[model samples]
Target chain A: MPLGDETIVLSRRQAEIGFAILAGLAGFVILFGAMEHDTGWSRSGPEAGYFPFRLGMLLMAASGVILLRVLLQRGPSEPFLSWGAAKKLLAFLLPLIGFVLLIGPVGLYLAGAAYLFVAIGLIGRVPWLKSGLIAVLVPVFLFIAFEYAFKAPLPKGPLGPLFGLI
Target chain B: MVENFTQLMQGFAVSLSAYHIALMMAGVMFGLVVGVMPGLGAPNGVSLLLPLTFTMEPVSAVILLTSMYWGALIGGSTTSILFNIPGEPSSIATTFDGYPMAKRGEATKALTFAFLSSGFGALFGVVVVTLLASSITKFALLFSPVEYFLVFVLAFASFIAFGAGSPLKTIVSILIGLALASVGMDTISGSMRLTYDIPELIRGISFLVVVIGLFGLGELLETMQNPYAAKAVTTRLDWAEVFRSAMIWPRHYASLLRSAIIGCWMGIAPGGPTAASFMSYGIGKRMSRNGANFGKGEPDGLVSAETADQAAGSAAMLPMLALGLPSSATAAVLLGGLLIWGITPGPTLFREKPEFVWGLISSMYLANVVAVIMALATVPLFARMMQVPFSITGPIIAMICVIGAWTVAGAPFDLWLLMVFGVVGFVMKALDYPLAPLVLGMVLGDRMEDAFRQSMLLSGGKFSAFLGSPLAVVISSLIALCILVAVMGAVRRRA
Candidate 1:
């Protein structure tokens, strides 16, 4: 997408537009869905849909006010997302994607260690040995602390029982 | 009250255990480290450790978490004073003057004052927790679901007033957060809202994941964007320079006492550290002719702001522990931890588990002393941590975020949800929405629904029951007033 103007600091109108659409969608979804489920203030004391229906009304009301505010606003233009900023954001985000993809295939400890090492090295650029040591040690410690010591069951992958080796 | 004292003495006996004292010390140390690290606030630290609390007895868990909170609050001030970086939202105001003072070659003095003040402030909060816990819980427990929801709504409305320039965007960001909160299973019915055929969304989103993304990952991204920002370098670290003995007792008596009172008041009111610190600092500044030198390495200014923040941070626990009312986001997360531990907060806790309550309170005394010593002793080390390039911490925080998200549900789908929330958080940040309220709303949303249902059911579905109780009426009115202020601010802006 081509970049918008960069000089503006606040973009109220754009925000309102986005919120309005979201609110309308949320309202419609809840209203129709709840009505279908027979949401009413009848015998079962305010039916299943009663609270949700009210919530939908709130969503619509808040969004409507937001939409009106945005439409009325006028000021310096804003670049919603700049390429430089996006790239910087992506630097952190892409690794996040990798970490997520790695989570299930590898258990939390191993995956967490890998994620930690890669992230630390990527940001700090410490000596490889130091970074590696930290990465391996942190997750191991956490696993021992939470999983073993605290008895909180963290995810264990195919190497599940093998994790006991650590 | 006398009985409360006897119970407190009993609590001291339980807290005096070497193992429990050691845990408090460890919690303080860990909390300080987490707080010193940019982007990981008290709430994130407490929530991340929530799983660990499972193995602990309730008293130990509460001690660990509360002490950790104390540590984190104090820890945040270290970054603000040393590196011009506030570790959390509460510390933001601290940097306005704190950094300026550090640059003027009084880093040691500034740090010392902060440490002392924070300790004093926390002690103040503890006193309130001990004295007023029963009464406070009774008052807060009377609030109905409608009142509680409106409190969320009203607290959210304050953002519009505060974020006046982009009120529309702020409201939008809040709605986005609310909508995101709605994605998981419906609290009233077992039905899902926006799961969209994914089982991961069935559990909804983890508040920790979103916080990690916002504070840790978002900070990493932000730091990278401003990579060329001026670096902080300090050369001097003399023991005598850091601690002035002659002024110690006099400064201590005045600064500590004033900051503690300010912290307790601010903590009870839910104004948070930002307000508490600034208020204390302002009072300190006004009291002394140090006004001109306040931000320029004035030892007292640093002490007042830093101390008040810690005090308020500790005092904030009063509401959470006693009333089940969280005065800040960190307390809210602690609330989550309390719920997870199967311990219901509020007045019943005292009657049901006095030992647990007393032990936790006694642990506070140990944690505060330990935290002050550890924080001051490790000053140089933490300062060096600031030198760790953003490039490395950036990726590492990202990794932690993933682990944290996955840990929340052990599902791959949550990883995606984490990203979605991260984007939403970033957008919210850009649009000027306060993320805390969103987290609070989501955390409390399910409970609010239940409270509403229960209250109605009890009253035979009489709508007026929400306001029938005097306590409920008072709270509901306050909530209404807050919303009125927010709506009025929005309307005036439009006009």
Candidate 2:
């Protein structure tokens, strides 16, 4: 018998099962590490590895329950991960990478402005002129507030001499 | 009695200083601004501004910073009332009734009630911290590593009970957090454990960075990911109407007192403000003439929430100052600040640093008055702060987050770690894992381990060491009960 026209959903249960397996593997790694570090019982007290060993057991136990549940579940088919969300996340990530790369070479002030201008433009789509004004003005203001007024040192670059004028 | 009086009087000596008072006022104003802003929070604000206090006298510096703490507490309600968005976690309950009232044009009434109730709650908490400081510290010192481990266990278990999704995911997230926490130094061996050959990872990760990435960057990413989005909600106020309505009815003093009690009590508990505010709001609804209007933006609802929220913020301080154990994130920052100042809080703090202790208390009273005036005056203006476009504001926040992270150790390595944690934070958020436990674990994990090792040594490795005294026995039993309850609750909820 044909079922009603319902969209097929991805097996959310399967992904959960996958996670359980991964967790079990990680648990073993942790267990191995603790055992290697001398976690055996002693006459007077628990040894150096006692707590971590217990935590590893707890992890394994929880993961076992999760894995069992995941295997027992009957579910529909659907995508486990969403591609659409990843794209949006990447937009921010790219600019963050750029900021990191530029910070040392261009200096904190200029690099900060560049990051701000680009990030704000990408996220808000504000006009370039407005974004530029904000990008340049905000960091400079911070420079004056933190570096000049408070005497807290910031990263110096080629423009370090220029900032000294403040 | 005379000693107590002299100590308090000496505290006033610092608190009553014109300079100290002025600094407190400034802190309150700054806290207000940060609290009302959607993305900014008390910890971020404190960390950002803490550097400025270096040159100020310690008393004045504390006065200012703590006032900012109070200011942020009150300022959070402003946005929660005007917009449904809570500026701080403590104000989440305020949005339930406060926003509904604002939507109906009772913005002024809501704001006014929120302001006054917060003032009352804070003053009440001040009295409690003042009187109960000694006893609380005495109680805290009795907590051994095993007891603290149990407390941490109970706290971590809560994620399974309170978090919205599958317990498996929450545990995974917690493990990840614990793993991350372990990346720095091996306490016993005095060796770098998981630095991955990076000199920066040797210091571990920064809490500020982790939180900012998790809360700020993750949120921004989530908002951008939403395909269908309307323009950000912005509101304009009719100042005259707001003021008129705000003054229409006298406040319920009894309700304020009740909420204050609720705040102080809940602040001491594990749930903190979220529970305190809800409990106060519930009580207000049950005991009000406007009971039927609870969710429709009644002014009384606003007052109930405001009183309890601020009171919780202040009461949360008791554990931090009295016990040297921070009950919440903001309290953690204050604790860290105290450590940096070479001041060890807890039972001995009263005897060793009476000036610091009393000075903090006296400043609270002054900060309350300062914050109230500042909030009332600034509410209308701060409401318009969103006018600053995201391009400008967003980057500024990120910059602050970066700077704040770097300042923790003054290392660029921490900055890199911050970026990584930010990404991890984003993923954890998407997976419905709570970040608080991870943070609590990171903060307390080493201490818990150290205490366990020390107790073992003391007992000559006897397991019975944990159950030696009646106090230890009772605390240990309670911890066992907590775990059993937590596990049972999870199973029931799943069923």
Candidate 3:
């Protein structure tokens, strides 16, 4: 399981704590919303928040139990993954996230092309000739498939108009 | 029963049209591609195509989606055999014998046998669906609102008890799903509860975000970390050998039937294909003379896994068609597709839109045959696809994931939700929590809410009235029994 890199072990406790915190936060939001909206029964029937209010309480209780169990349990801590593996995952994830974020301003086609080029050329270390060809072709292929066949609209930057050989 | 048969035959006529047939092929092809590739799965793949189907006929659309479903199930076995990687969760058991067979240069034999068994299992499940459709509809009609509510409870309880591991974790995942389902404006009183005045939250979390993020992005992240070994596979397919393999498959006829039976029952009962495949494989191993060879390339092992996997896959659609209840993640997505098509799937659906229901069933039959043939013929094609570097595939998959999320609402905010849910999906996977229940919960949450609310109104808001009907009593008792067992298990563990 070693990936030939420095690694830090992530215990079950740390993961459980994070999950419990998430549950607690969700519980608080739901509880507050239920209270604000009123979970009481009206003349017709139950209020909108009635069932969710109870559900929120159950969620909070479950989180409490999880927190308590993690605190009490002495579980074995195993190596989660190597730093290299983690970096590999984050490498793709962060770039993809960035790609999505960039799509808003740079447009889908341009953003997509840039993401592919960089991920393949820089991150993957693939040859420029191969990566460059795929980068150019993919967005073009998508443009035809979605825009022409499906008649779907994609986000566009100023350069998007140039592809209007359509 | 005779009338149902006649209608199904008529449905064949409707679905056999050149246009619908083409759509079926397209659907199956799309399903196969995604099912073979890592990261993208049947549910997300179907969801990606769902928005495009708005202009198509409901019958054509449903046929296409269901065809994709069948193809995905068929496609998963191919990946399992050739690459030792299960493209779908249900195919995990196949890897034990399938990969071993491939390693021993029996890849063609194993693939042929698995495909044949899968086809046989699917056909058997479809026959069961066809014969039992009317009767099942009758049974479902007995359900009142209270009974409907209790049925959902029984489903959730069944998953929590029988899912992969840790009932408590399953419960937590289901609760997380239910909680997320409550984020949008409450439909009952027109009050936004969990939105916290955020306009984006008003529509609530889209299940598409959760599904694509979990199965698509999360799986991609997983693959990047724990990459599968790229093993060499023999792509030689000999007709004589394939025929010999098929001929000898009858030796496990009993196992095949038993697996199909197990698969169909589990599929209908909500255990789903993964559980059904494992159960069938386990039983086959116990019964076989070469039980010791189960994991080392036994043909019976391959047959048992494939048969049950395909059978359970096809049968999982039964509840969705009959009671509007989805038994699997892909089925849930199909359910969402149905809702979008403005078709309320219940007992009345068959009575109202007989053509659509029967056509879909008939298309299932055709799609099963088509998918098996296509899979067998294209094994080499998929084998090559297996060798394509994930570096190239990964970015393409990411792009598609982006398009899927963006197309859902045509908003940047939805992409952010997709990313958020992607991280949540990754964490959940690491935590060993069963995710199927979460997706199912979100899909059924709205329907369950309506049933619970209406039942309260009908009973004058009295909780005791839930036990009035015999059907309701039965379902409630079932739920109570499950909870009791869970509690007893907990108490025993504490001691």
* Per-prediction interface RMSD in Å: 3.9, 3.5, 1.4
> Each candidate's TM vs. the true structure?
0.87, 0.87, 0.97
The candidates, ranked best first by DockQ, are 3, 1, 2
- The runs of at least 3 residues in candidate 1 whose Cα sits more than 4 Å from the true structure, single-residue gaps closed, are A1-36, A108-166, B137-197, B227-230, B252-258, B282-288, B491-495
Best by TM-score: 3
| Per-model tally of clashing residue pairs | 12, 8, 0
Ranking by lDDT: 3, 2, 1
lDDT of each residue in B1-495, candidate 3, tens digit only: 998899999889899999998998899898899878878888889888888887889999998988888888889888898888898888999999999998898887898889999999999999999999999999988888888888888999988766775777787788878877878877777777688788998888888877888878888888888766656476557778888888887888887899999999988988888899999999999987778899999888999999998998889878989998887888888887898889998898989999999999999899999998888787778878778788888888988998988878787888987888777877788888778888888888888888888888989999997789877788888888888877777788889
Q: How good is the docking of model 3, as DockQ?
A: 0.70
Give the candidate number with the greatest lDDT. 3
lDDT of each: 0.69, 0.70, 0.85
Model 1 TM-score is: 0.87
Docking class of 1: acceptable
Model 2: per-residue Cα lDDT over A86-133, one tens digit each:
555676778876887777777777888888888886565888888888
lDDT of 2 at A97: 69
